[model samples]
Target: MRARALVPGVPALLPSYASLDDPVAPLRAACLSAVGELGPRVRVVASGPSGRRVGAALAEAVGAVVVDADETGTLVVGNGSATRTEKAPGHLDERAAGFDAALRASFDHIDLALADELWADVTCLVGLPPLADGDVRYDDAPYGVQYWVAVWG
Candidate 1:
């Protein structure tokens, strides 16, 4: 691939979900910058419809077109863990930290069952290279959701 990017599939990143204060400003900026680096034609890899929509939105915002073939870039949408805190969507799974840490190490071997329990969106990450192989722009569990904005070439 000429260019590749990884971003969380958070609905907050969408323009339609914009709030007055913008809770995800930094993440949005990072996503936009990574997406902007992608060429005009991008192929989006996402686990579900929401994730797909988020990828499409980011690509569109950067003036990139979502394509099925002849892609100049690839946008992969997924995240680590969602049960990082008590208020997390998955409600504080004690195993979240370890699971996310292992995931950060490599995406080559993921336990789908455990991932599901922790609310991790990693299905689209199956064939992609490790995140450590790229430039990680953001890595945090803001609002209890583990998010990473990374890029590869």
Candidate 2:
């Protein structure tokens, strides 16, 4: 099934790991930004001017190995599986007790601006990896808003 078909309805809280304070990037790099392997449920983050470059960077990052990443887009590389919940921290912390702690840990210090439904957090790609699940790759230029991603270890 198309990963987007399995979009989760529960409200999610992990905002992009990137921030506006990011150094200005060149246009060509932004045009080819990689969206990475979000697995089954790819939340297409609409990265603005730097969309292409960010996506390309993310795609390369996805191709590389990632660890302790419970938020941002969970890339399912190689043969691995993870359990995810509506709460982001719970998914990361080995000892997360409930939703509140999870939320605090996940969104702590992260800047959040209200985006349309298009900006909702992505969830539950499970065993799918970008190498195998390329659906998360958006070949086109970003609509404008690129995502800031962070891997909380």
Candidate 3:
């Protein structure tokens, strides 16, 4: 079995929350492109209902199906710290950058407590396979929030 993608649970990705200017245009495009790579049937792993909704919307946009059982591809929705800078959602935590860096290196042995403190949505990332250099499709801190879109086979 192979995991298809790792996308952020940013509400802006959804059409319902879209703005007139579309602040996350590039990120949204990258996510749709990555999600489109997964074959029709996909399993979604998300942190909560909102995350699941984002995954479902993406799947719907790409003509993919979200399956509950027996799936070859999995779509995991989550993100790094929301406090990368002063304008970040969690508002500037000095430790946010370093915390996100460690997560980017390896999802193994994460300090859950610290993750919560930093406002990282890593609930679904805990069990994912280690990320490799070439697997990353996007890695940037837009809106002062660390977001990544990666694929793993």
Candidate 4:
């Protein structure tokens, strides 16, 4: 139960979305490094099926098995606002930056309604300890989607 990690459930991280040039190379490396630290058993918490798939792939990539209970580590998949820019998946939302800023400060209080409007998958993000208690390996909005790769050990 010591290991904990959070990675955005971006399709770009999945093999199915892999490109010959590898658009998300740095993100993949950060995810692998973080997921590698989780022991042999990992409990994955994701907002939806797609996120679950991403978590499963990451855990398997590191030789870890996804377990339902009694896991040695936990992988929570989620992300902040996706409407950060004009090219964002959900398109630009004027409230996105402020929303993401609040999230960065604390996951303690989240505007679920606004999150949905901004296309943020934060259902699994609630109740986590805090990013301040861990190391944030990656935090950027590449492709206009806010993604974070963090681990707590």
By lDDT, who's the top model here?
A: 1
What is candidate 2's TM-score against the reference?
Answer: 0.20
Off by over 4 Å in 3: none
Model 1 weakest 10-residue run by lDDT: 124-133
Candidate 3 lDDT, 67-90, residue by residue in tens: 998776789999999999998988
Clashing pairs in 1: none
Tens digits of lDDT, candidate 4, 12-67: 88888889999888999999999988899999999899999999999998999999
> How do the predictions measure up, each by TM-score?
0.97, 0.20, 0.95, 0.97
User: For all the candidates, what are their Cα RMSDs to the real structure?
Assistant: 0.8, 15.3, 1.2, 0.9
> lDDT (0-100) at residue 7 of candidate 4?
94
What candidate 2 gets wrong by more than 4 Å, as runs, is 4-45, 64-153
The superposed Cα distance between candidate 4 and the true structure at residue 148, in angstroms, equals 0.7
Q: What does candidate 2's lDDT look like per residue over 95-147, in tens digits? A: 22232233223433222222112232322222223222232221111222222
**Distance from true position, residue 40, model 4, in Å?**
0.7
